[model samples]
Target chain A: MAVLTDEQTMLRDMAREWAGNESPVGAWRKVRDAGEAAGFDAAAFGTMAEMGWTGIIIPEAQGGSDFGWLSLGLVIEELGKTMTASPLAASAAAASAILLGGSDEQKMAYLPRIASGELVATLAVDEGPRHDPANTAASVSDGKLSGTKAFVAEGDSAGLFVVAATDGLYLVEAGEGVSVSRRHAVDFRSHAEIVFDGARAAKLAEGGTGLLDAVLDRAAVLASAEMLGMAGQSFDTTLAYLKQRVQFGQVLATFQALQHRMATLFSEIELMRSAVEAGLTAIDRGGDTRAAASLAKAKANEVGHLMSRELIQLHGGIGMTDEYDAGFYLKRMRVLEQMWGNAAYHRERFARLSGF
Target chain B: MATLADPVAETAVDAFRDEVRAFLAANFPPSLKGKDNAMSAVEGPTAETPEQAAWRKAMGAKGWGVPTWPSAYGGGGLSREQAKILAEEMARAGAWNPIGGMGVMMFGPTLLEYGSEEQKLEHIPAIARGEVRWCQGYSEPNAGSDLANLQCFAEDRGDHYVVNGQKTWTSGGQWADKCFCLVRTDKNQKQGGITFLLIDMDSPGVEVKPIRMISGMSPFCETFFTDVKVPKTNRVGEEGQGWTIGKRLLQHERTNLSGGGSAFRMAGPSLADMAKHYAGVDGEGRIADAELRARIAKWEMDWRVFQLTALRVLAESKAVGGVSEVSSILKTVGTKLGQERAELIIEIRGMQGLGWEGEGYGEDELHSVRAWLFGKATTIYGGSTEVQNNVIAKRILGMLDHQ
Candidate 1:
């Protein structure tokens, strides 16, 4: 973990407490069981707003704490542990996009509402299932945008979309030409495939050529933070299980084989955390973060997948059952792995960024 | 646009910086710049060039070589921040600390913590000044990972103990002036029976034979003791407290082996760059072999993640005591990465990597092959990977012990 300031420590502790009390995995289970198209509970996000989590990254003038990306990452990591189903990550990414490129008018119109949790916004980059931002087919013409964005998280809930076009980024409200249809992913989160037949496009032209990539990089770090949480909780669950569950008249943790496996997972998870925190730090530093973002998400995907798999296998038969929460973590892990970029995607991207 | 010194000008830091500069300018010979004696790490006091000898002597006298140790014991007694400044300045000047060995790295710190006032008065000054060399007398043939199972007996004879036992893999044993030994004080109990004893290496019946390793280097020795007399006054702690003190010392050793800030770490082009030199590049400026390219990329990413974790650990541990649990994790990860890096280097070399002899092989190529072989001992030595996992599990993770 980073050497967090007193403020960051308090914020992280507050988020952990709130997530544990208000929205645990059971809360996500309820949302998933209810089959809501919006994915997360509205009341949960309202509570988030009340606690000022929805505004950590937004500037003070825009009704937020402006604590920065590391602060936001710390909050999101806590949310991730409890499997808190919210558009917090998505909305934050969208907020970052606007903050980076949106005009003062856009900031006044959207930042406060987003901070208050009254409005949810999301970044739509890939037009296909995979997260390929550079291969965008969406185009803007005469203040109108037309194209498709596949598997957009929080799409059903987002009132605004920071759409990535072939040229750059443009903001489009979720109405009229913007049609959101259900895209059922394995995690059962709110995902949508939206077809925009010339939606009213407001260009984020001030962000210049690299705006879309910058926005996606921020989103990747956000996703990595969540994965860090899930991976950590998975390890904690397994560690607790190993201590209690006995076989052959000895606790499972006593076995050298199991102990070594747990140790390996523990170290790998630490690396994953380091990568995520470094990425968040890089984003906060406001320097070139392309390589950092790729490495972060790549490690999250790599370790998250391994850890989720190990979480199940370590728990034995009970882990395979639906009643157990291990499978939920694996499900979420698979989805998040594919979110910003999978291991291979980011590895390739990292190689390109590193010029290897 | 500003120099690194701009922010701290005219402060106490600047004064100290000036003092350091003055000290270096007067004492540090320009001819010795950028050249660290490679043998310093693996061997003891080989015949040094006049400049090297002068450099070591000057550093020892000034005590800046062991900068963070107490000044009462002839050390610089600098704060952590000051030590960091000294490191930066030294690196900026292409200077490396010439005063280091097991005495400075592990034993000196442990002795300061656990040794008596008289013992500290007697021993620490020499260690701080890099005047005497020390070797560990802990591991034995019967006790590798199960170090407590050691059976080197130290029979009590009122004023002194007659030590009659052997300690293997005693690193730099032949070169050391003294040995910090773990001797069995009681034959009845395992851990409770151990005693920490200091023995003069030149004493009668003390023998050290350097063992040739697969790396073709004789860096370690098979140390034997045959009725070697060690005085009761030389005992570090209580008779039965060796296990506690020895374990604390191992923590220090493990931290050093963890490779966080060890000097003499490889420096040059990265493995990817080296691979490009060996294997041709494609049209897109990528490694020619896609599979090899991906593997190199993966290694770089993993290595990066490890380095970041090291940084985080350093930051989190500020204003705190020793990060004991973290050291095990560092040792396990760092050693594996070291081994992995050697393999990647070999992979980059292809058939050229296997060169071991005089003709046709570059000095670097031959050295790397030996380093690759020597790297295997790293994981096995400073608490093997399996033992480290046990440390993580039982100690750090609070898992149940074997009943």
Candidate 2:
């Protein structure tokens, strides 16, 4: 493991403790059972905000800790380990979009509220079932926004939506002329399909073609980090089960075939970890964030899906049931895989970024 | 937790980088640029051209060949940061580390760790100076993966040991000046009875028979030792401790085989360029075939991720102060990536990739075919992929040994 700074270690320990104690997998199960009305635990998210996590990526002057992208990734990774359903990743990502393209006045107006957990926000980038960032049918003209955004994570809860339009990113409030209807996802998390008809919208930035791409890249890196945590947790759980569960009078792990499969998953998870860390490091160091983010997301998507499926397959019949947490991971991975950009999407993006 | 790089140290490193850049510009030969300087290919005697020999001599004399080794042992005696600077500078100049072989990669590091004062003085300097070549004698007909089952016997005489055995997959054995061998001194114990010995290849009974590979190259040999007499003083550690020493040496070998030291250089034209050349491109400059483009893109992304993982491992190793099972992980991942690249190259070339020797095929096509064949052996050698997976499962994942 890379040496973590004192602050980073402290942050990780706290996040881990909180995830285990306040919001374990059972907590998520309960939230899932409560349906879309309960959404995520607002109190737990407020606790995270109190811990200065939501402000990790925002500038200090904007009421944030300014701990950098890696710090934010560490928190998200920990939250993901327990399948904790919250708006942390979504809010932080929306904040990043604003920081990237929002004017100073805009930042002053929204960032403090986001940093304090007074507002929940998310980036509505996906317009259809497929992950296409450039083909946004949403548009803003005469200070009004129109078009529908599908698969908007935390959209049901988000007071603010950073909508990707043809021109650029536009800020739309959750009030009049805008509707957010809850969309049931396989993950049982509260995602929403949001439609805006002549909603009063303000542009975050003007004539910056790469602004939304930058925001999406940042979001992708964080999403990759979260997926890495999810994959790691699934692998660990399956490995533990393998050691305990016996078949044919021997522990499941004693079987070489199963051992090799678990080993492969371990290797892939480590690869995703390294890629996610590299992406976070790139963002922190202000390097080639685009390629790094795409690489991380691509690897995470591939590994996450593989690990999720393998977890269920290795666990056998119980894994297929909705009662088992393994299904939750599979469902979560299914959503995250298609979020931001799937493997295919990022692969092509990576190719284009490489000047192919 | 470790702190970030010190500002003063960073400044010193920057200055060192400048110095290294200047030295490389002056000393690195332009003719050697883009030339293959793989240690495995050039280690043995008579393998190097006069140009390679000159480059090796220059690097060895300057002590930059083994930059991190002690100066008393004919090495640069540089710090890790300085060594990294040297490597970066050499890479920037397209200069290869001329002094590399089994000696530098496996034997040298192991000897430095376990060798006695006399052994260090005798062997370390020679290896540092790139004056002698060494080949490992570990695998046997019965001891491929189960290495401790080796039957190469060495009877301890008063002054010398009489060794009689055959070692298979002895890489570069034909030209190696010496052999770092494992011989079973006692047959009762599987591991504890083994001994590690250094033997002269010119010893009366030592013989090497080349093994023709699928690549149509004889890079390996079956080495026979028929009652060869090796001196008692040449033994590396305690007789029974050979297993430990051997494992340590394999660790070094695996690390070297993983391409950790020289990963920055692109071996040839990238997959994108190959695609553009052969598969053609669309108006948007994308590959004409969508599926091929997607596959190439996936491979390229994987390659980038592999490189990043390698860097992460390096950084983590520095902070943690030891290499974990990650060397095994790297070995598995690196070889697969290499093999995948070769596969992609062959796929991109189409019919030309199938050529062995023909008038129509270009040098790149022929080389790609050869590389593809050679790539198959990469997973088999230096611990096969399955063995590595087992190592990872047992060591890193805390799985019980199935065997």
Task: Tell me, by DockQ, which candidate is best.
Answer: 1
Please identify model 1 stretches exceeding 4 Å from their true place.
Answer: B1-12, B43-45, B262-266, B319-327
lDDT top scorer: 1
For residues B161-248, write the lDDT of model 2, one tens digit per residue: 9999899999899988999999999899999999899999999999999998888877889999998999999999998889999999
Give a tens-digit lDDT track for model 1, residues A122-184.
988888877787788899999999999999989998999999888888899988999989988
> Lowest lDDT 10-mer window, candidate 2 chain B?
B36-45
Q: Report the lDDT of model 2 for residue B378.
A: 84
lDDT of each: 0.88, 0.86
- Please tell me the TM-score of chain A for candidate 1: 0.98
Superposed on all Cα atoms, the candidates' RMSDs to the truth, in angstroms, are 2.7, 3.0
User: How good is model 1 by TM-score?
Assistant: 0.96
